[model samples]
Target: MPASIIEVPVVDPPLAAIGTSDGDEAARIQARLIELGFWVSGADGDYGLTTRQAVMAFQKYMGFNDPDGKVDEPTAAALTNMDLRPVSRANSGTLVEIDKGKQLLYFVIDGKTEWVLNASTGNGQSYTEPDQNTPGEIISGVSLTPSGLHNVNRERPEGWWEGDLGEIYRPKYFVGGVAVHGSNSIPNYPASHGCVRVSVPAMDWIWESGIMPMDSPVWVHDGA
Candidate 1:
């Protein structure tokens, strides 16, 4: 018998230009493409060749005369109209807040709150005698979390911590090493080398939530 034909259904792409591939939108597109028998290696919100091929295959299946690897109107429409299953909304919209004084990480989602186990802050003790009484005393808590608008600039799977100090594990977002990431252990006080410490679950939630847009606002504080 000849090789069986795996009947693949058609998928209409979204009507809207499917906004920039970031956060939830990217994840959704990736999932849908994979479901339609398209090879999407990973869902990182990047519209690469794999995603394009998937779109093209979907278009062909949908009976479109021009099944080019482009998410044109018809292709988008097919994907949008398909009877695709919905993904779970776990880690939908969560914001990360790092408190230096309290040494805590907060995940704000849907107006609710989820706190990480423990976190440490920068070293507040130990200082050299300022040039033999040149200055009275160096102030503590001088290095506050640089307050400003920032975002998840970069994300690394492994091999990030080679010449790093302190206790921080998977460092995902690197805003000058002041990232919101996972750690081996978190203390209930300032102890980090200079990075925000969060739990693994919390880190994963941040990644999945897709709320932290590029150049998002990040507010760091001493204490309320």
Candidate 2:
């Protein structure tokens, strides 16, 4: 048997339907874009300019004849092949909680502590520039490790805090900009710009243990 070559037929953009109106449809589109390596602001149901732009970019990458910002039949067919489900614990191992306040990374299995390590988080108490009066604060809300259940959304070979730090090779976990990654130097307390800092050994352990599977659940408590 030979692999079938998918021939994308020419089709006009469905103007009758400008964009997705359903929340689930938007989520699917957003997930498809993300899987195709396009960063999306949010998966809200509104198919605004950003989503359209992302769609065009995806089409261009696929070598389409016209990378128009419209979801044509070809685009729809390509998207249908993607797995856009949100990350879930059911597909991964136990939850691993990193307590920024306590400076500890706890690996919990079946509601029991399996391993622990000294970690560091965004020093919500430093200034990036000495002349500036405002202290360097981690972006609030989404950037801040919310005190609730979330998953290890994605990982990147390169760190997202590109401009902040000088050029350096490092892997970052995209659980927000905060990641469980290695640091050349670890300060006594919270020091990262916003990410969760782990020792080289600790990072290797987590990666090898498969604790933080894609979309693995994470909980950040305020120690209340």
Candidate 3:
């Protein structure tokens, strides 16, 4: 099937928060967002936090400043003309490519981004956590998601994986102490404690769909 050609009419600038007044238009926008791999269920033309979060995720994938999940004219246009294969360097094989600068995660198979999810990585700040083994002694590390190559070495199914920093939902561990897991909050910014965070629904879908199976290569790069 070919990509759908969506023609969204140009509308007046948002007088308040930007959202859909028309149910049909909202459905069309939701369809495009889901097709591009942002996790959003029930595109029954209802626009709410779920749709807004999906839009924020879409904006992150497109390397746009997503302060609000408003469906602007340009954003709608880009979604309509989305590129299936967004990442250029990883031209072959299956890999999890994370554009840290873009704050987006791409599940690539055969050079195409099967799914694009909005993610939050380390915020480059530092925090102190007491040692697991030694009491009264703390260990400190900068809250930075390391950029490089990694492989999915472990996965936790249907449970929360506790860590020194925090707990992750259904985590798929790639690097030491760093995995892509589900979270209740997936803000459109870098706010993790050195791990990558996706929405709970997105993570569940990834696991259910086997998007990041064991030994899958995960490439973290700044350039999208």
Q: lDDT of candidate 2 vs native?
A: 0.52
lDDT by residue (23-44, candidate 3, tens digit) is 7678777776665557676578
TM-score of each: 0.41, 0.45, 0.80
lDDT of each: 0.49, 0.52, 0.74
Per-residue lDDT over 36-120 for candidate 1, one digit per residue giving the tens place of the 0 to 100 score: 4344556777875445544544554454665555666556666766763211111334455555544444444443333222345
**Which prediction has the highest lDDT against the true structure?**
3
Q: How well is each residue in 106-165 modelled by candidate 2, as lDDT tens digits?
A: 666555444444455666644433222234633233234445676777675443334233
- Best of the two (1, 2) by TM-score: 2
Output the lDDT of residue 35, model 1: 62
Question: By TM-score, is 2 or 3 better?
Answer: 3
In model 2, state the lDDT of residue 16.
Answer: 29
| Model 2 vs. true fold: TM | 0.45
Top TM-score prediction, candidate number: 3
> Model 1 reaches what TM-score against the true structure?
0.41
